[model samples]
Structures are given as C-alpha cells and as structure tokens.
Target: MKEIESSNLFPDRLYLIYRVGRLAFSSGIFFLFLSLSSISKLPVAPSSLFILGIYVIVSVALLLFSKKPYTFEFLLDEAVIFTLVASNVLNYNFFSIFLIFPVFFSTIILGSISGTTSLIFGLFLHIIFFLQKHNEGIATGVQTVLNSTALIAMFVAGLKLERKLKSQAFYIKELEKEKERTEFYKRLYEISANMAHEIKNPLASIKGALELIKEGKQNERLLEIIFKETDRLDRIVKDFLHLSRPSSPIKTEIFLPEAFQEILQSLQHFGKNYKLDVEPIKFKTDARGFYSTIENIVRNAFQWADSKVEIHCHKNNHTLEIIVEDDGPGIPEEEREKIFEPFYSKNPNGSGLGLSIVNKFILENKGTVKVEKSKLGGARFVVRLPLSEEV
Candidate 1:
C-alpha cells in the first residue's frame, strides 16, 4: 500500500497545493501593485507599467483557475510555468524565491518526484529570467542558485521523512486490521459456543429418543438412517459447544509432530469407516491451543476429503506452518473469505460453524488460516502459528 502524508497545516493534502498556489498568486499581486504604484511616482518606462498590468490580469486568472479541482499534474506544471512567465514579464527578481514556496509545498503534498520536478522547473524559469536581462550579472545568479538549491534540498529531506512516516502508518494500519479480525472471531466464537451449550441438552435428548426408536422394531434401514443423521446433528451441536466454551486454562509445551500424532489417532477412531491418509512432519507450537486448532482443521479436512486426506506441517523462522489438503471438491474463490465466517458452511448437512470455530481457535493462538486450491485438487487450508519462542 502507498503511504499518504498527513500534516495538520492542510485540511486535505490533495487540496493543499491549490490553496498554497492561490495564496502565493494573491500575495504576488499585492506586491506587484505596490511596486507599480511606487514606480509611477518615478520616471519608469511605460513598457514596464504595461507589463505589470498584464501580469496582474494573468495572475488573477490563474488564481481563479487554481480554485477548480484540476489534476495535480496540470496544477504543478501550469502554476510553475505561469509563475515563471509572470515573473519575467513583471521584471520581479524576488518572484523566484516565492516560487520555492510552492515547490516545497508540492513535495510535501504530492511526493518526491513531483516536488523534484517542480524544483527543476523553477530552476529553468530562473534561467529564463537571467537570459531576459531582467536580473543583473553574478550577484543575481548566485542568489537564484542558492535559493533554488535550498528549495531542492528541503524537498529531498521532506521526501525521506515522509516516506518513513508513511511506512509507520502502513504498519499501524495492518496491526489495526489484524486486531479487528481477532475481535470479530473472538466474539463470534463466544456467541456460537454459548448458543451451542444452550441447545446441547435438547439435542442429546432427541438423539437418545431416536436411538431408542432404532433399537425397537421400526423399519431397519429407515431407522438406521434417522439415527445416523441424529448422531451427526448431535456431533455438530457438540462441536459448536466446544467452540463456544473456553478450553482448560492449563497450557503445555507439546511438540508439533506429537500434536499431529494425537489428532491422527483421534481422526482414525472417529472416522474408521472413512478413508484417510495422514502424513506428519516436525512442528513446534503451543500444546493446548495448537491441539484444538489442528483438531478443528483436520476434522474439516476429513469431511471435505473424498477418500483421501493429507496433513503436512513445515517449519519457518518463528512460525510453524500446517497445510491440510483434501481431494474433495474445492471451494470457489468468491466464497473463500466468507467461509471463515460463522454459520457459513457449504455442505447442506454442515452446521456452518466448523470453520468459524477453527478461525477462532487459530486467532486466539495468534495464528491465521486461509483457503486456497489444494495440491490434492480440493480445498487447502494454510495455517500459520507463531513459533514457541515468539509465544
């Protein structure tokens, strides 16, 4: 992201250039009128007076034009060119110094390249003044050079400082965004967990009654299907409750690979009938939070995987990376961001809270989860957890 400069001097930085330009032109007009009035008392040339009048008219017109919302490019180029022309016409040697104001102002408002261009244009105008015989020999040259050089130096320094400020601003923005995401997931987890806890008893009662009905001499296949569905719903409600409630406060230092081993063992016991392939590698993370987060992800992977599932973990500096990939149908890009939202499941049978819960767990543990195309030709979940040292 590009950083924008914020200074209290201007209400809006983009509009500031024009504001400064208008002020400069108006001030130039007042001084030009004073000079012309004073010259009138002396034996100045008629040509000089005529030139001053023309300068005033053109400067006023430029001031009015500057009031409009012209592009920054046009404003800088036109303002500098016109100011230079006006200075030459009015035989104003001090106008070059006044031009420096806008150049410095433009650099602060626009950026380095623009400020430098304006400064160079001002230098070219000074050269024009020198050639026109408007200003004298070595003294005028030296003064003009010194003023232009100072303006250029100020602009360069401002550019460097502005860049530094912008970087800090961008970093702050990123931090804020991460904070908001964390808060959102935190609240969502709390609310869903509470609702799930409230409904758990009722779901359990229904599941028990359904099982009793299946145990009785009801139609065997129909009863079995109903019982199975009730069981799925019961598991969904339990998952919701688990996500809603806070885990035990106790934390342990568990190696990442051992955590995955436990998750694989649990998945095997839970999904013995379903085909699953578990691959493991070295991992380092917080034991309890990492276990919960991985369990949620692995469960989701199992649900989405057709008959194949792959879990891979890698290590980077200060982060343990895990990729849960499946061979089932992948999610579309448009729905990727929303899938992590609570109650946004794609499967008809899903409660839509699994990924939401996963997101909450990851965030609480200072990690992030994102969806992408899996190497297995299905949905891939990329998780990044801070290393133990960072924690």
Candidate 2:
C-alpha cells in the first residue's frame, strides 16, 4: 500500500483527488439506487429527476477528470460542492447528511482557505434549509450554531493531521540518510584500520633491513628483501586508495584476447602453465579498472594453482564474460561468500584485501564477480561486464 501511495502514476494532489473522486462516484451510485427504489411514490418528479441526471453525469465526469491533469484544487472542491447541491435538490432527510462529505474533503485535502470557503457555503445552504423547516425558535438557532462549531473543529483537526503526517515522513527520510552516512563512516574506519595493520609489518621489515645495512650487513639478499618490502608497502597503499575512491568506468574499444594476454604476460613467472582462451572481439570498458580486476584475480589464482591457471573470455550479446580457474584445492563452499569481504582470509600471509579490491573495481565498472568450485579443482572467479555501445 505504501508503494502504491508513492507511485508516480498520478501527481500527489491528483492522486488524492483521484481517490476521493472514486469514493464520490461510488457514493453517488449508491444514492442513485436508493432514489430509484422510491421512484414509484415520486414518479417523474422534475427536480428529483434533474438532480439524479446531474449526479450521474458528474460522477462519471469525476472518474474521467481524474485521467486528465485535474491539478487545480478548486476543480475538485467544486465537484464536491456540486455533490452537496445534488443532495440538497434531492430533498431526502437522509441525503442532507451527505453535505458533510464536501466539507470533510475540501477542508482535509484543499487546506484552510478552501476549507473555510466550503464551510461558509455549507452554512449558507444549511441556513436556507433550516429557515424553510422551522420558525424563528431559539432551539433551531442553537442547533445550527452547534453544527457549525463541530464542522469548524473537524476542519482544524484534519489540517493538523495532514501536517503531522508530512512531518513524520520527512523525519523518517532524514533518519534514513543519517543512518547511511553513519554506516559509511564506520566502514571507512574499518578499512583504514586494516590498511594500517597490513602496511605496518612491511614498513617494520624495511626498517629492520636498513638497520642491518647500517650495521655493516651489506649482503645482496638483505638489500633485495628491503626493496621487496618497500614494494609491498606501496602496493598496499595503492590498493587501499583504489578500493576507497574508485573512478567511473570510461569504456573504450579494446580487443578481449589482447587485454587478457597482457595481464597474463605480467604474471608469467607466477605459474608455469598460464593458458588463455579468449574470443577475438572488440570490448568496451575502463582499461585501468579492467586490468586491475583481472590482475588481482589471476595473481591469487596463480598463488593457489599447482601447475596450471586458465583464463577464458567470451562475449555473448551485450555481456562480456571472463572466467579464471586454477588447478589447486578448491575453496570450501562455506567460505566462498566471505572471500570477497575485506580482511577475511584463511591464508596467514594473505592481506585478504586482493579479492575485496577486485570486487570493488568490478562493481564500479558495473560488473559482478563470483567465486565457485571450478572444473580445474580450485576456486573459479567469474566476471560479467555489460558491453557498452558499439565503438
């Protein structure tokens, strides 16, 4: 019902009026039936028949009018006014109570100005009927005054209720936005903590290596380890920044096989058997993000593969699919979902951020990556990217 109420099928004002119009139509039909049932006593009465005809026309017109813009509030208020006039023309004691419908709707929906106007008009009609039905008695005047007071009270109360509902809706929206901002900052803090922990060890190792060199330990292996630790620190910082502030994918035409082959070449020493099978097609995606996504996935695969890692790329319709599989012990099904979570790795030496970063880059490019058991007896990472317009 909330979804229905929020739907854009009709503008907000029109939608309210549309609902009221439906109610008016249904009420008019019900009264029309009642009048027809008593038609034998007043057969062919001109005023009753005229009111009946006008009510029928207006009821149908209200339904049709809802389809049009019908934005002007006065138009709906006037329609309800016509309904009140119909009740008056019918002259049935039961029908007079229907005068409250116009007052109720006009005040509740059209606000105070229109509400007060409707009240004045209803009072004028009430006075006419009251004068016709009674002599100048104090009791009659008292009843009229009491009825007017009750109508004014209802109008004021309805306006307050409408304002309260609007305020509550706005408050709920603000609370939701505040909750989102809080959650974002919380996630950011977690990422910063993890990055600091990961980078601290490598910096410490680099510091130890420099200290050893200062103590006359000029071994080539010591210098090499320092360089490797420095590189490790750089990579960690780079990955953190890449994950945090991802750029939007600016798709450009590039051959699928060539791109995959380039990534494979860089990690050739990581595994003995690096195989690539790609469809020769022009694909479109952000080159840097695309490269980072595949590189991180393949590097992880290479770390696990016993002897072989296979890369397969295909294009079908408007989707580009890439699958990287390795020949190693497959990932347990329970951990598959957790692998993409930041700082969640089973490997002791693993920073656990590679797959998380891969997922982020892929998502920024409007792609998805999933891990599953592979035919190669290891984890398989499947990437799906929507193809851009033809270059």
Root-mean-square deviation of every model: 14.4, 6.6
lDDT of 2 by residue, 209-261 (tens): 89999999889998898888888777777776777775654767777778888
**C-alpha displacement of 151 in model 2, angstroms?**
5.2
Number of clashing pairs per prediction, in order: 1, 0
Q: What are the runs in model 2 whose C-alpha is more than 4 Å off?
A: 1-152, 216-221, 244-251, 272-277, 305-310, 325-351, 370-380
Displacement of residue 201 (Cα, Å) in model 2 is 0.8
- The lDDT for every candidate, in the order shown, is 0.65, 0.70
The reply for model 1, stretches above 4 Å from the true place, is 1-12, 15-238, 245-251, 269-286, 388-391
State which candidate has the highest TM-score: 2
Backbone clash pairs for candidate 2 read: none
Query: TM-scores for all candidates?
Result: 0.47, 0.64
What is candidate 1's lDDT per residue for 205-301, written digit by digit as tens?
Answer: 5666577776884566656666666776776777767667765556655656666777788887445233333334444344555666778788888
Give the 10-residue window scoring lowest on summed lDDT in candidate 2.
Answer: 1-10
